[model samples]
Target: MAVPHYAYLKMKLLGPKGLIIVVGDYCKSLECAQAGAKLAESLVIAEEQRQLDRIVALANETPAVPALAKEPAGEASFQPSKETKKVKLKPEDPSCSKYVIVGTRLDNK
Candidate 1:
C-alpha cells in the first residue's frame, strides 16, 4: 500500500527490499496543475462552441403560426393566457421580421 502526503509532496510505500519514497517538486506540480486547469477550461469552451454552432445552423428556421379560432363576429381572435404575452415583431427590430416573441418560457409549440 502507498500513502501520499500532499503537504510534503511525498509518497511512501513498502518495497520488496525496504521502504520506498517518491518526492514531487512544488514548482513542477504547480505548473502541471495550472496546465490541467487550462486544458479543462478549453474543453468546456469547445463544447459550448459546438452547441452554439448547432443552434446557429438553424438560423433559417421559422416557427409555425397556428391559425387563430374565429369568433361569431367573423374576426380572428387570440387572447393569450394571462401568464403569456403574444407579441408581434416590432419595426424597431427589422431583422426579426415575421417572428413572434412569446413572453412565457414555453417550449417551441
Candidate 2:
C-alpha cells in the first residue's frame, strides 16, 4: 500500500504594523489552499476599500465653495473664470491608457 502525500496551507492576515489580525485554517488539498489564499486576499482588499470609501465620503461631505467677504462700494472683487474643457478618452491608445486588474491573487502554496 502506498501512503498519500499531504500538503499544508497556512495563511496569516497582517495589518499595517505587521500585526496578525486573523489566521486561516490549514488546508489539506491544493484547491482548499488556493481558496483560503483567495479568501484572505479578498478580506484584506475589502478592508482597504472600506477605508478608502470612508476617506472619500469624508472628502465629499465638506462644501467646496468658500464664503465671500463683504466688499466696500466701488471696489472690484476677484472672481475665477469657470471654463470647462472637454476631454476625450481613447481606449485603444496604448500610451494614453492601460488596463488594471484589481483584487486578483495568485497562490503558490
Candidate 3:
C-alpha cells in the first residue's frame, strides 16, 4: 500500500503569512520548513515594497496635474486665470523628482 499523504505543505495554517514546505517526513522538520518559508516570504515582500517605492520616487520627480473635465465638488477647487497644459517642475522641492533616473543611472554605471 502507498503511504498516506500528510498536510505538510500547509503554510497558511503554519505561519502568519507564508507557504509551508515539506523538508522531511518528521513533524519537527515540517515546523522548521514552515519557519524558513515565512522568513523567505517576509524578505520577498520587503524587496517588492522597496522596488515600488523606487518607482514612485521616479514618478514624483515630474509634476503634472491631470486634466479634470469638471472641478471636484468642494471649496478646495480654485479656477485658474488661464488654461495651462504643460507639467511644471516645482522649484520648491527637488528631491521629489530625482529617484528613478538617479537610481537607474547609478545601477547602469
Candidate 4:
C-alpha cells in the first residue's frame, strides 16, 4: 500500500524523558506551515504549563532547598543545567514588501 500524501510527523523534544509532538496538516490540502504552528503551540505551551503547575504544587508541600532553585533529579546527580530556553523565528510581515507565497499549485490551474 502507498503512504498517504499527508500525515503527522513526530518531532521529539530532546531531554531525559522526551516528549513526542506531532505536526502536520489539520485539514486536507491546507497550508502545512499554518497547521504546524497551531499544533506546536498547543503541544509545547498548553501541555507544558499544566505539567509545571502540577510540579509547583507538589514542591510547595515538600520541605527542601530554596523555592527558586529546581529540585535535583536524583541524590547523586549534580545541579541541573540552566540553559533551558526557546528560540522563536520572527514571522514574515505581510505589510512588508519582502513577503511572498510561492510554489502553491492553484486548484483552478
Candidate 5:
C-alpha cells in the first residue's frame, strides 16, 4: 500500500531501502488528463453519429409515398358539379377580373 500526496504529485511506499518515493510530472499529468477528456468527447460524438445513422437507415427502409397519390384531388371533376355564379367586387370596373365565385345553392329555395 502507498500513501498518495496530491500537492507534491508524489506517492510514498515502504521499501527494503527505507521509504520509496514515486514522483509524477505536473505537465505530463495535465496533458494525459486533457487527452483523456478529448478521447471521451470523441467517443460520445461517435456514439451519437451511429444513432443518427441507424435512424436514417430506418427512414430509408420505409416505402416512399408520392404527395399527389396521398390526397386525390377532386377539384377538376367537382367544378362542373357545383353551380356557381361570379359576383364582381366593383361592378363599374368590369374586365373579367376581381370577381368571387358565389355558389347559388343557398338561394335555391
Candidate 6:
C-alpha cells in the first residue's frame, strides 16, 4: 500500500520525572505539526522561567551573614595602612569638560 501524502508528527509531553504525560502521534498537516511544536517549546520555556524565579526567591529569603562574622578569631581590625594619593583635576582638561559630577557623598550613603 502507498503511504499518504501528509506527513506524520509525533509529539510527547514529558513530566519532571521523565514520564510521558501527553502524546500526539498523528498530525495531518505541516501547520498543525509546527503549531504543536511551538506550543510545546513555549510551555517548556515558561516552566523553566518559573523554576528559575522560585530558586531566586528562595535565595533572597535566605539570611545573609555579616562580613566580620566570617573572619577568623584574633584577626586585627580592618584598616588601610597606606595613605591614598589625592588626584587633582584641572579645569582645562578635555576629558573633565565632557562630564559633570554633582552628587554629594551623603546622598550615596
Maximum-TM-score candidate: 1
Q: By the lDDT metric, which is better: model 3 or model 6?
A: 3
lDDT values, one for every candidate: 0.82, 0.60, 0.60, 0.59, 0.86, 0.59
Q: List per-candidate RMSD values in Å.
A: 15.1, 23.4, 21.9, 29.7, 10.2, 14.9
The runs of at least 3 residues in candidate 4 whose Cα sits more than 4 Å from the true structure, single-residue gaps closed, are: 3-30, 66-109
Worst 10 residues of 4 by lDDT: 99-108
Supply candidate 2's per-residue lDDT for 9. Answer: 36
Which candidate gets the maximum lDDT versus the true structure?
5
Which candidate would rank higher by TM-score, 1 or 6? Answer: 1
lDDT of 2: 0.60
For the record, the alpha-carbon RMSD of candidate 5 to the native fold, in angstroms, is 10.2
TM-score of each: 0.53, 0.31, 0.35, 0.31, 0.49, 0.34
2-106 in candidate 2: lDDT tens per residue?
222233233455557874533334443657878899999999999999999998898799877767887875538654335433333555675775454322232
Regarding lDDT, does 2 or 6 come out ahead? 2
Q: Which stretches of candidate 3 lie over 4 Å from their true place?
A: 1-25, 63-109
How well does candidate 3 match the true structure in TM-score terms? 0.35
lDDT of 6 by residue, 14-100 (tens): 567874533234534657779999999999999999999998898798767545556654558564435343333565775763443
Model 5, 33-106: lDDT tens digits are 99999999999999999999998898798767545545566765445437878888889976757887777775
- Ten-residue stretch with the least lDDT total in model 5: 72-81
Candidate 6: which stretches are off by over 4 Å? 1-28, 64-109
In Å, residue 97's CA in model 1 sits off its true spot by: 44
lDDT of 4 by residue, 17-103 (tens): 765454554554367777888999989998899999999999898877756876678878775445443323335644544443333
